[model samples]
Target: MPKKVTITDIANLVGVSKATISYYLNGNTHKMSLETREKIRQTIEATGYQPNKIARSLVTKDTKTIGVVIADITNPFISSVIKGITDTCTSKGYTVTFTNSDNQEEIEQENIARLKQQNVSGIIIDTVDANSPNISQLAFDKTVMVDRQAKKLRLDTVVSNNRESTVNFLREMKKAGYQEIYFVSFPIEGISTREMRYQGFMEEVTEDSSHLLILEEPGVEKRIYDLIQKAKDKIAFFTMNGPTLLAFMKIVNKTSFRYPEDFGLGSYEDLAWMDVLNPNVSCIRQDSYQIGVLAARHLLAKLKKEKSSSSPKLLVVPSESVIRNSF
Candidate 1:
């Protein structure tokens, strides 16, 4: 095998000092003349020199790599977010390490600890439980939370306008003559995203806890069937997210109920499968990819010391209402 090229070889070939090559490698080109920079660049390209990231990180104390912990890797919405993060980090000349928590708090804590052990420069997490004690112990300056927020922890967060968007969509349902609207979800359980959407739903529809359908509860399908059968007024259902929407649909599909004829249907997440249905499902569409991009940029800013804010800020990304024949 041919010998590996080093910075010293490139410096010798370019007839420049190792310090000059170091400056060029670190993006400190202002210290050298344009001609010298061009010479060093050309020599390095010819020699195919690769820098030792581990050694450089030891000297600079920066890995130029970001760690990501995902709550649910199976979610299509989260997949898009990961795509955005990967694309942005690639363009910025940074590498990423990814971990999946599978929506388990214990797994999430373990993933976080593993990433920390790897000595990652910073971390971006889609936490399973925002209120988990492990989240509060993360380095606030180097960590950014996505999709969830802990108000007391004051960690910088990026999330959709869940409440505002839900309220707007439900109002549209109300305008379309939905006398009763039920909010369907798996469980709130202090999850900020679910709680915010539920709050938005409650703001638009004034109803008791009876209207809140928990999919995880026993006999939920029977309850939903009974609710449909006993309805006297024009009633509709608004699901919390894509997975919840799917579970709700599975229950409804078992019966002979149809949308807008038997009952109206609307949902928080706009998934591709929803559009392909016989009568497309109207839903609130969040820019999840943009949320990921923004979260990465924010973490990068903090890592580079470019962000001046001493207090953690909540950045809200806007959502769009996709009106369809479902409601």
Candidate 2:
């Protein structure tokens, strides 16, 4: 049986001291000549020698690993974003450890602390509460935010253009003759994603502020029934996300309510089920996966010391309004 190759074997084969190979593995290639670095690189590549990440991390006092936290892993939109993150991180040879917060702020905090305890190189978060001071502190260094963003920031963030896009799309719905438009959301408890999306709705809706509707988990059916009564002809409604849209649809199905002619429906997430809806749900198509990829890349930049930004920079990714028969 053949034995596994070790660093000692590589050093012996290259006729260099073990310390030189050690330095190279620790990313201290600058300590040696470019020629030596290239030769070691070539030999390592030829021999299929994989660095022992565990042992090397112990020596460097840092792991080449990233910690990711998601608000709700059950959400279809969030799962895709995680895929993008893991895909990019794996390609870059970084290990990923992720946690799901299930929309609880306290849990999100705990997840952050847990990541810190693990000594990960960086963090990427889709937070339930972006208003926490701990989140802001994390932004100053190894943390990058994805999807939901903190209102005030000191770190890099990647997100869909929630406010501007919502405003523009709602105006289009208005232009197409939606007489009574209501912004339907789950709750606005200072959650940044919901806040920004609601903010966009407010921008285009200059009339009565009463158009905003909060969907309470309890008595939702009764609440939706009452809202249904209040809606007039050509009524249009916008939802914050896919899950909210699903809940809204349940209430909609309770009665004989129709769409476009009777009402208009649009939502933030363009989930796969929306396609199967009879009228083809009009919605915003955010590149959720791309948003994740960008966030991961930015976090990598900080870990690699390739970034120069000290203050927070909001990186907004564009979204599309999928105009369909629903609106």
Who wins the TM-score comparison? 1
Give the poorly placed runs of model 2, Cα more than 4 Å off. Answer: 31-35, 136-139, 217-233
Residue-by-residue lDDT tens digits, candidate 2, 19-48: 899999878886688888888888999898
CA RMSD of all predictions: 1.8, 2.2
Measured with C-alpha atoms, the lDDT of residue 144 in candidate 1 is 91
Local error of candidate 1 at residue 175 (angstroms): 2.0
lDDT, each prediction: 0.89, 0.84
lDDT of 1 at 123: 93
- 1-327 in candidate 1: lDDT tens per residue? 999998888888988888888889887798689999888888888888889998888877788899999999998889878987888887887899999999898899999999889999999999988878988768988999989988575789999999999999998999999998899998897889889888887787974888999999999899899988999999899999989989998999998998979999999988999999989999999999899899999999898889867688899999999999997
Among all candidates shown, the one with the greatest lDDT: 1
Task: Show pairs that collide, candidate 1.
Answer: none
**Which residue window of length 10 is worst by lDDT in model 1?**
146-155
Look at candidate 2 and tell me the lDDT of residue 297: 90
